[model samples]
Target chain A: MSKEYVLKEVEFWDGAMASSQALRQAEVDIMAAYPITPSTPIIQNYADYLSNGYVDGEYIRTESEHAAMSACVAASAAGARVTTATSSQGFALMIEVLYQASGMRLPVVLNVANRALAAPLNVNGDHSDLYLGRDAGWINLCTFNQQEVYDMTLMSFKIGEHKNVRLPVMVHQDGFICSHTAQNVAPLQDDVARKFVGDFEAVDSLLDFARPVTYGAQTEEDWHFEHKAKQHKAIMDSINVIEDTFEEFEKLTGRKYNAVESYMMEDAEIAIVALGTTIESSIEAARQLREEGIKVGIVAPRVFRPFPYDKIADALKNVKAIGILDRSSPGGALGMLFNEVTAAIYTNDTKPVINNYIYGLGGRDTTIADLKQIAKEIQANADAGKLTTPVQQFSGLRGPKLSFFDMESSK
Target chain B: MLEIRWHSRAGQGAVTGAKGLGDIVSDTGKQVQAFAFYGSAKRGAAMSAYNRIDDKPILNHEKFMIPDYVLVLDPALAFIGNITANEKEDTKYIITTHLSKKELLEKLPNLDEKRVYTLDCMKISQETIGRAIPNTPMLGALMKVSGMFEIDYFKNAIIKVLSKFPQKIVDANLKAIQRAYEEVV
Candidate 1:
């Protein structure tokens, strides 16, 4: 029996708590998770809800991250609404099962509070975990703050559980920056959110013994290629379902979301494409730089999986030059976001001079001063009709200047 | 928008103080964001928390550069980090210190006396809560300096948040807040 929760019209919550509240509202069947920072609060709050009788769900305390995800797969295949959360190394440990969940077309929603991987051992916000899960075949969504963390999570269930798109979804937010930061969030009424997410339709659940169906079947070379193509079609078909869900959510809450969120891009000659909280800061930077006669704008991809290439390309179709900020550390190469964005716009007629800046790895701060300098460089490159310096360099690097991968050839 | 920064040690209730202030302000239909900047600090190590309040939605989630006010929960941290890095023209500093305003100016030699407010928050916390957590008194002092919210609102909010605690603890915090509210100058 699901107990009704008395949710405030508006409340103050951090990102993790907001996500946990969304999961509570969804009335998930099972949450099998191993707590990891800064995503620990997502699971902790859910566990608290369970203990306090606020939510009706089973809270599984697994031995490790791998076991947590392994339990989620089992629960999902058995026709249960499954969800879990992890970050950094925990996410890396669950990487193997992530593919299994998607390959089996299980609609398990995972919340990932993105954190930097350990090498010299650091626990801070970055996109290394996000990039690591890029090609895992799950539908990926990005949130800027607490509000999106709530909204995107509710929508992830609908998008993943749709009949046309039976794929797991991963909802991500910056680790400590978004997870630990307390802010205002206007949440939907419990019944309104419930109606919007609707009911889950389990297709061929393992528990339906009357029509016995087997999951995780071995399709050798005979049918392997056909099965893989069908999986790819499902991911590609999710785009329409995602759009429809966003529309339905907006109609209910009056908050609209897009696959690609653009700020001041109209008539902009220079633009910066970034993700997560950086988009909000870049809006401030664009406002400040505009006063100094710089035609700067900002572009952010709200959806990373089934990558929003067409929307991203269209947003930058008119800009003269663009700068792509990637938070993940590039191991002797360019950042993953830079590579994806370049591929997105390579065939476009705009052919803007693109520059890739690998930044904020290991949680280094990105200041407005750095953005202003980048704005100036993009403006200069636009006016000169060419890149002024190296196409790719590490923004906010502490040590001596060193650009990566064919950067020397540019000089 | 009014942005404020708080400086304190790791175990000194900085995050809680900022979050408390956020909850109070947001209760009055205003928007608020409270966050901290730390590099895995241990107990007694220096850390900072930031608060941003505005009538509209807060878009930028970055750290503050030119905050309207700076509240120092520890007098010792003033000498280590750039506590006074960026401030508006008439930025206020509500600090916890044993020294008088005149003596604090003499020690710093750089701080202006007009905008500096000091109170013995440690003594207040010790006498009331039986600890060195000066955040309550500091908030009390901040309410007086900024005048963003009424003193009663803060007192009531504190009481409400600490409602689950023992009445003695709640009463002591209320007394600490009241004493600092009247005592800071």
Candidate 2:
């Protein structure tokens, strides 16, 4: 029977309920976290669960994210399903041990609400935090909406706990987009989530008292390389497990998802590739452009670790030029999404000129009008043969236009 | 398609009103969509909820550049921003104010004079329900302006949502919905 989960709709939430419902489905046995912007509610929600008897879990309010990950590592190694969440510099603080959680073969799932790292501070949605942990050995995935956050949080546990892929996973949601924006989400029923995830077996094969042995052994130089080599192989094998897990999740719940979902890409001439909330807005833009007899579509990249290179390349074969809409600047380099598009193109003939767009820095809004502006720029760049080696231009931002209005006049 | 642009700050329950309106009108077997464009991404910031009630499925998800009807739950918003941006010659503006339509329009002369219908929704909210969540109350004023449903239909529609609360609160809210339907001029 189909049931409607009547969540408080879009603007009413403080993100506490999203975190609460996810924690319930995760059935988290251990929670160790420090509070940070846009992600404080995850801990607050878990805390409420503990006090109200909504869930039976030991919630550990740690001093820092580093300590939190360390506690999660310990709990998972000792046969407990663990979850810890963080954002901004707090998420960046876990980069050191996050790698170890994978190499040590622990299945700790984390909720990373994406926010910008500091120089000038930002407290809103962006992917800089998630990008900083790209090589930390955890399987990283991004979500666009609150529904995806709830669904992906539960799916992360299943994906991590798969025996063949005993690695940690990070389910990244744009801070305010999914976290703060409330929506009606169909949460996983306890019986179904428990049945699917099953019982978690601790990684230590010698966990049995009868055959106790040392774990995390200090090895000679020769064994160190081989051990790390196996960890790399397991992380790579997660690609297959991710697909299988989705299949199982679909059977349990009637929702279908993918590593890379292509929208209206059949014989598309121009494609805008991006991730997170912008993709939803971009899809609407693409549909509108299609109505006007323009051949356009969106390549929404969901998984970031493996990057779904082959899948994206195969789909974009018919398309000509592609625009990479990145929310963050790569400084002297091109935007992050632009580089990924180039890498995905196997051949130069099939490779479209990828225009790198670094738009909406410091949590600026990316409206549908802004999306149309990007499309116009992409078309112009394509026409002028201007996309040469990933040039980053100043993008659409609201303030006094600096073209004629100098900042000194204001002071 | 009759598009209504709902103006409210975050946590003020305009989104709930949008969904409730969608549910109530959908019983008439009309196609409807309810969504919002949020801002500041916080507990309290200016936000806009939207509804497109039509005989066909709504394809446009963007905020309406020109809305057919405007519902303002906050009276103070009149001073802060242009709450009536998309008002056509025939568009109706149902605003929650402490004053009558003429007095409020005299204060906010920027608003269109031809089709503005201002009611004291806060008084309706306070007197009928004993609280100041003006979403249901403004819906009463909207019912008067748009002439879509009877007061009883909206009362039943509100009952579906308010049933989740305690009986006393739910009954009060139902009474508020009913009174707003009759009382709003």
Top lDDT prediction, candidate number: 1
Docking quality band of candidate 1, CAPRI definitions: medium
lDDT (Cα, tens digit) per residue for candidate 1, span A207-242 = 999999988899899998998899888998899999
User: How much DockQ does model 1 earn?
Assistant: 0.64
Off by over 4 Å in 2: A1-22, A46-50, A184-188, A205-208, A211-224, A346-349, A381-390, A399-411, B1-69, B85-91, B143-165
lDDT by candidate, in order shown: 0.88, 0.73
lDDT by residue (B1-185, candidate 2, tens digit) is 78888888777788888877876776666766666664345656778887777775433334445688888888887668577776778777777788877788788787745577777777877887788888887887787767798777777766866776888887877777777777666
In model 1, state the lDDT of residue A232: 87
Clashing pairs in 1: none
DockQ of each: 0.64, 0.20
Candidate 1's TM-score reads 0.96
State the local distance difference test value for candidate 1. 0.88
Chain A (alone) TM-scores for all candidate structures: 0.97, 0.89
